[model samples]
Target: DGGGVRGLSSLLILENLMHRLSPEKDILPCNVFRLIGGTSTGGIIAIMLGRLGMSVKDCITAYHSLSRDIFDGPWRPKAWQTSKKVLGLTGDAELRSRRLEEAICHIIARYLPAEEKSALFGEEEIDPCKTPICRVFVVATQQSNGRRVILRNYPIPYEASRDMTIVEACLATSAAPFVFAPLTAGPEGCRETYIDGGLGNNNPVAIVLQESRLLWPRQSVKSLVSIGTGARVPTEVKQNLMSLAKKVAEMIVDAANEARDFESNIRLTEPSIHSVYFRLDVAESMARIGLAEWRMLGAIAQRTRSWIFENHDLLNRCVVTLGGILLNCLCITLRYLSKC
Candidate 1:
């Protein structure tokens, strides 16, 4: 029903009443008071808002505290059990790795467009160390923990290139000490960035990153205003932007940290501990990278012949004895288990 002259007041009461009646168990009900203040609100409001959002966000923080309470959670359904049934009969390590990658890919697809998959600019997306001289390095972080560890390793020989600048638009998306190859500026020197994806045909998007540079578009202003024609970038607005940037920076660092810890845990739990050295086996990795180079190939061949001469036996094979045993210890016991 419409109120006569007091329509705004009636609407406000109704809205406030509804908010008050929302279930209390939701932990966080919407904070509507923020909208009530006039446009002249101080920078503190924006700062508080940034802090509030950061506090509410799910940062993958690791807590080593122990508790005696029983921990119980949800179980998987029949669909997952069926997938495991098929997975159990497979003995190929490559197949297992592919399957795991595929599952992760499924989730990635829902969020990202097709082009931004793991295969962009080589596998070492964010390697800390510089590459071999004569090529470019790329640091595209897929997912990360708080501050450390670039988790993927592509078998590629990095011949470093010269003249690189570590470019980051906002504090949040900045890389840690430049593991990736330095970003060489475009021929034009500086870029005119558009607000969103829209621009000319070649908009020149930066890489799909773990965190976005959320620099909001500045409001348009015109000199010699006629009542409401223009407004400059106020001091408060700039302060708010700074606050937001800081919060985002914290989130990015936390994401990198989480990814770091997860990779470490995966290495510790690997079926073969030797898999730990799989990335760093320079001889084997070099052979993989330079498979096409005849000179490198010959070098690897000579090395292989030398190794063979040193050891007489073949690289022995282990047959799969546990036939079609679809067992998942996830259903049994594991102290650490939580939904992402």
Candidate 2:
């Protein structure tokens, strides 16, 4: 899930899990998880961990740095400017999209190999067919058709061709509505504009499940972890027009309840996999924070820590199960090497 700067909560939760998995040393999630998918800010997290192969701690640090850089300037436009932009008289955004693109490019450059440096925004591909270490994808909503598109680092048969560069994929997925301009990408004469995937897929648990089934049709999923960016206070629906507008805006901004609904569906429909499915989300004090409140990092961290302490038992079980999965993967790889 993506909640602008609130994504810090997701990172904090993953950090706790990584610590529990390997207390003495750093264990990269890319080595343990087969596929990782995310949307909007969560998409950024997916790239940092799955595509760049960063440790959770390092990813947290990098997230802090880039968020500061991307959201450093004034984020709200003047009343007149906002009115004009909203009325379609202007296309300017309050925040500079270039800042976001540059920050993402810098991070990608730091991790990419020297030989692939020149292909940062060109023909460089990010797919399991090319780099089998970990499969990663970011979700985006196509503006023209209002359909969900997966910018994958792995190929899926019969899906749209995976010809976009890593930088383009990151840009498309992170293009939040109104906050940043939508990205127009693809080959000439076939371009499509893309906005944030959070419009309908703020919680991408369903996408992850569907994509996993497509990737491994015969194999049953062993573990599925759905991390969320803290929960929000539920709002009551009102009959007044102003209240209805407010409610609609809130729904567009954050889809906290959707995450819970998806979890419930998983448990009800697939009872057998329920034991292996883990959903970690902080439960209190997050509703007061705004999505773009970057200065509230301290409060976010504190809340996440408290939540972790409170749910120690649940986290421990998740860690133990993940550890077992890692061990099994190691054994399978060793057996294949022996056969070779």
Candidate 3:
């Protein structure tokens, strides 16, 4: 579920599944989940759903609106060229900070009023507890030492609070190294830059499992479900790489490999967990950002219903299955290979 833009496909499928649960409306009640953890785009959806209490439709609308601007809007990479050059930190070196500001603005626009933007991103420190949602964890990576920074109900110093807004923190977690600038969050004195949480935990289901155990030690996990973007890798490798194609191939290989591993490991250890992965027409929908993509999401959503019908026992006996399947190392391989 953590393949850059491809992750949106998973979110779309999730929206549909939520609708199926209620059938009448898109709202997923808070009781449905004990805790939620996400990486990158997954984190964005989790925050809106868990913290902001936005409906599935609201989340979908917001993401669709931002899709176009992601590559060409003010927050687009290198969009802050002038600022970077004037600051004497020219080239792509300063693109991270520039894109960071743009991402912050985009988030502020999504969650806050125009008047509140300045105050939210300003010097005044706001308490995290005041936020509506607290049972959410955003996984991020610490650049200096490559630590997995789980952003949840942690203590923050005055300076860190001043510099980091919830939007900024989420953006920091979503910032893919090299693709987007690494973020300098935490206390002002702390030099560790935070990057995409995907570097460490793309599936992030483990975060939910581990944190749930810590928070409610006595309660056994009731049900566990995960939705992914298939996370399939191509079996064929092109022997020839010419110029830019080589770099692109490398990036592709890295993502496909990571995604494959994530799905494979989850299936082996957690078979009872109902996992839905979008496998049809993934490549066509990956870079797209429009109604067409939305339709594709709808298609994937329908497929989930079919999957559920086919695997009734998996959902009904999720808890029992989890216990029994603990030692089952069968890797549920994906049927389709995505071009991500």
Top of the candidates by TM-score: 2
Would you list the clashing residue pairs of candidate 2?
127-153
* Cα deviation of 291, candidate 2, in Å: 2.1
Instruction: Name the regions of candidate 3 deviating beyond 4 angstroms.
Output: 29-31, 73-134, 154-164, 235-340
Q: Which candidate would rank higher by lDDT, 2 or 3?
A: 2
In angstroms, the error of model 3 at 243 is 8.7
lDDT by residue (tens digit), candidate 2, 1-340: 8777888989999988988888898888887788898998899899889878888888889888877887675555445543444454424442457777887778887876666632212233443234545678888999989898888876677765557777777778877766678889877988889988888888888888898899889988788888988777768997865555545546765666777787788789988667788888886578767666678888889988898999999999888778977776667556655655
Using TM-score as the measure, what is the rank order of every candidate, best first? 2, 3, 1
lDDT of 3 by residue, 103-209 (tens): 54665566655554332223333343243223666777887787887776332333232345667666767766545567776565755678778775766766776
Better candidate by TM-score, 2 or 3: 2
Instruction: Estimate the Cα RMSD of every predicted model relative to the unseen true structure.
Output: 30.8, 3.3, 11.1
TM-score of each: 0.17, 0.88, 0.62
Local error of candidate 1 at residue 149 (angstroms): 16
Q: Model 2 TM-score?
A: 0.88
Query: In candidate 3, residue 121 scores what lDDT?
Result: 27
Cα-based lDDT at residue 89, candidate 3: 46
Residue 142 CA error for candidate 3 (Å)?
Answer: 1.4
lDDT of 1 by residue, 159-253 (tens): 32222221111111111111111112223664222110111100011211111112112321110000000111112223454444433322322
